[model samples]
Target: MAPVAGRPRPGDPLDPDAAISVRGLVKRYGDFVAVDGLDLDIRRGEIFALLGPNGAGKTTTVEICEGYRSRDAGEVRVLGEDPADGARAWKARLGIVLQSGSGDSQLTVRELVTAQASYYADPRDVDEVLALVGLTEKAGLRGRTLSGGQRRRLDVALGIVGRPTLLFLDEPTTGFDPEARRQFWSLIRSLRDLGTTMLLTTHYLDEAEALADRVGVIARGKLVEVAVPSALGGRETAPATVTWTEDGARRTEATATPTAFVADLATRFDGEIPDLAVARPTLEDVYLQMIGDDR
Candidate 1:
């Protein structure tokens, strides 16, 4: 059995420039390995999404970085401090918005945000934080009375009230309706614009695509790949599928040069190609293929 907390290995120094860094990370529970020799780096002021199927090491890895769980062996740093040894000042620089909303039903939104702000040395204005999360209108409402989406917004408000330089958001928009999800995306982008480095974990591929500057996929306790949303697993250069209606029947073909294929189809039809569509692999497509290969 691996020990819960171990010293950082020699030559594994904390990187001042990185928002979060890990090297040869290992974590185990009883006899089962949860994280195995994983390496990751998240740059400053970027939104990085860690994606994987259930039971993958995504949560374990995040927990380790957040200092909520101890690692068996590794060098893990968040905001240039070893998480296992992070002091109160270091912890103040990080914010975590969990998957579930806060369970403090008695506190009003304003009171909760105000109380949380008191913990930080230089916290954001309480009213400003509420406005940032679109909760100003419901400031006096008790936590239990808010709708699901509103509750999630309050979670974000609490997370950002400290003005943390780094934020961890796990499944932030899980229960939001379509419009609410889009609104949440805008809010995240606004935070990114303010230079907040973010680590996001979500099962929603579309959410990852919309928010992540880069995405890393984990499988079976290992990282499969990491790339920008457009290029993850070579999605940007994947073969395109060209489709059209021909003689009242649908026809399709995969080709490397979709523009050339469409030009040829235009010539063959003497003008317009009927019901034409050209598509390349989406982020979801590449992600599924990556996970499939890992299995």
Candidate 2:
């Protein structure tokens, strides 16, 4: 498949503004190829979401970028340095939040963040980090006593306390309730405002649409497409589905020009259309179509 439009083609010069860059990345387990010639570029200060179903090699690709796994072939760069050779200083520039929180700890929120902060040469203020994650009120509470949402917040606190320029979030809002998930999304946007570049991996299509500046879908170990949520797979141009109540029964029509269709419908109704709803293909719809068969 062709690389997504606007992405760096293979052998192109490294983008100085990119926080993460991959070219012809490949990884194998025995004879099975997990990641095959994947190429991706995440620009600085943008939230880039990597999405794929289970067994799609997204996890392995992320691990390779994180320096926790080796690649069989290809060039991978995080923060302008090869992750395989990243030193203490290079590692210090990164923050990672896994799908699950570190198990309940004996330390209070403040103490846990304080300890995490000490590892960096210049970390964010301990109190500031806690407040940023909305855990300040729970600072005195031990980790084991916090609720699920609070624990997730604490995870983010620890991740950001190091003042990392680049952060990796894996299913950050997994298991969160609706309200809590929205709260977490707000926090992610705030981080972006602070100019922190993020690479997020999640199964939540809505979350990716809400938070990411751009999203990439991986399937069969290859990057199928990369685009802003609005334009992915040409979602913007996909036909719209218009549904309404007509003749006492529900009627549906697919149209390329919803606005014109609705205008005619209004004239037919002489003023107002009954129970009207016009919707174009959603991000989820486009995503599913892009990953079809591969799933």
Candidate 3:
């Protein structure tokens, strides 16, 4: 089993190799606490997904890391520098793509990307970034003329033109269709392969399972757990639910050794079992349970 990560002790030293690290993170609004004593560490070159329901402090925490918001208390280090004190060089090492984008600009695709590329010290070639996001075909089209998925792709093109070492993506696939989402996932994986560290926040459980190397769930202003998608909440060791049709009705049982149980059932019937099915808790199931969502 993969090792699970938990909150670090208040005095624990910062991880030297971590792309982002937090200790005793806290945030508040008037009488409400949005984040409380949270600790997390995201390694370099890995895609880390932050998952939480609405009003769960996910955005507040991410904003603090991105240096867009001030924290009431805690320590945060991004790219080995405190975000609050980040300089131009430090800022250039990071890229941000917000949930909503300015894709309605009148500039053409290549024009916008080229303009964005000029902001960094060593940006990727304009045409290559466009091709990487599958936007080469729409290079000449104005942003307002592109479809929703195409516009999202354009957003990514702009985000990566700077060749940032660390990128933060917020709900990147919000307007994408299934096929488009899958294509975007491939682009993200390719970025990870090229040694770009990423921090992602999204409502899609399947997307997190597909792309994230590690996932951290936040509930009511605190981190609940951090683990690989398959092993979150001990799901890997949880019993499997086996179901089959028997005696003119359906029956079900949960077992840890599903393979042995199935073999025994096969012998009892002396043939293939009718309507046999095996299932386990899904990522969504565990996430919802973790957040205490009774609905």
Candidate 4:
């Protein structure tokens, strides 16, 4: 099958080609385990989405990988270095866009981006970064005056100004409207085209479907499964629901052989079947089922 748009085929993250790798990871909050024996690998240039419900260890795992939180056990390697021991040079190789951001209210977009660029030994052009995140027009706008979506773009601009090889996006579009969300997705796709490896955590299933080459579902501190979005959780092989309109009513049947079923329906009608649809389980369906079973 052709690869998903804006994403490449999945590869092993531990094969010396991975941007991020985690093995037998574990994290505990005293009596409770937030992450337990999880293993994951994100290839050098693919967008990987991590999904789970609240209290499912998603954030903890990400934090550990990003070197913000310490892991109780297991090994993690980001950009071939342990984040806990990563130096300024090592950090410059990674970009992070958190769910929320903090900035001086009076600083203009250009000023903020320029200041961020100063931290790295080598950084992308400030104006180019602004344009890349769709903030070129708002370069002179103060941080306090920008709308929510524009501010989010600025956050992204700051994240990428250092030309990071890998990016971590945590709930990147939480407050965006549909149109703004789509625009942000376009920006992300552009970054992926530039060969940026990304680890994304989001609750939006469609966003995951649209951007992720591979998705790993986490629950109760463990990774339940990891697969390409189209085939995740065995969705590609799951039974399809064949439906059609008949005598002013709708008819539906669940079947594994949707093609044969459709052929029979066509023979019955002796023409094009009315309102025919063959629907398979979506990524969201499999995700919910996996998390639910874990609980």
**lDDT tens string, model 1, 232-275?**
87788889999999999999999999999898889889678899
Residue-pair clashes per candidate: 0, 0, 0, 0
In model 3, pairs of residues that clash are none
Looking at model 4, residue 56 earns an lDDT score of: 91
Q: Superpose all Cα atoms of candidate 1 onto the true structure and report the RMSD in Å to 1 decimal.
A: 5.2
Considering every candidate listed, which one attains the maximal TM-score?
3
Over 4 Å off, model 3: 1-11, 293-295
Better of 1 and 4 by lDDT: 1
lDDT of each: 0.87, 0.89, 0.89, 0.86
The runs of at least 3 residues in candidate 4 whose Cα sits more than 4 Å from the true structure, single-residue gaps closed, are 1-15, 247-249
TM-score per candidate, in order? 0.93, 0.94, 0.95, 0.92
| lDDT agreement of model 1 with the native | 0.87
Candidate 3: tens digits of C-alpha lDDT, residues 1-295: 1144554566677776789999889999999999988888988888999999988898889889988889999899999999999788998899888777754789999999999888899999998998899998899999899998898888888888899999999889997899999999999999999899999999999999999999999998888889898988889999999999999999999999999999999997957899999989899989988997623
Q: How close is candidate 4 to the true structure, as a TM-score?
A: 0.92
Candidates in descending TM-score order: 3, 2, 1, 4
Flag the better candidate by TM-score, 2 or 3. 3
RMSD of 2: 2.3
Task: Provide the global lDDT of candidate 4 against the true structure.
Answer: 0.86
Off by over 4 Å in 2: 1-5
What is candidate 2's CA lDDT for residue 277?
A: 99
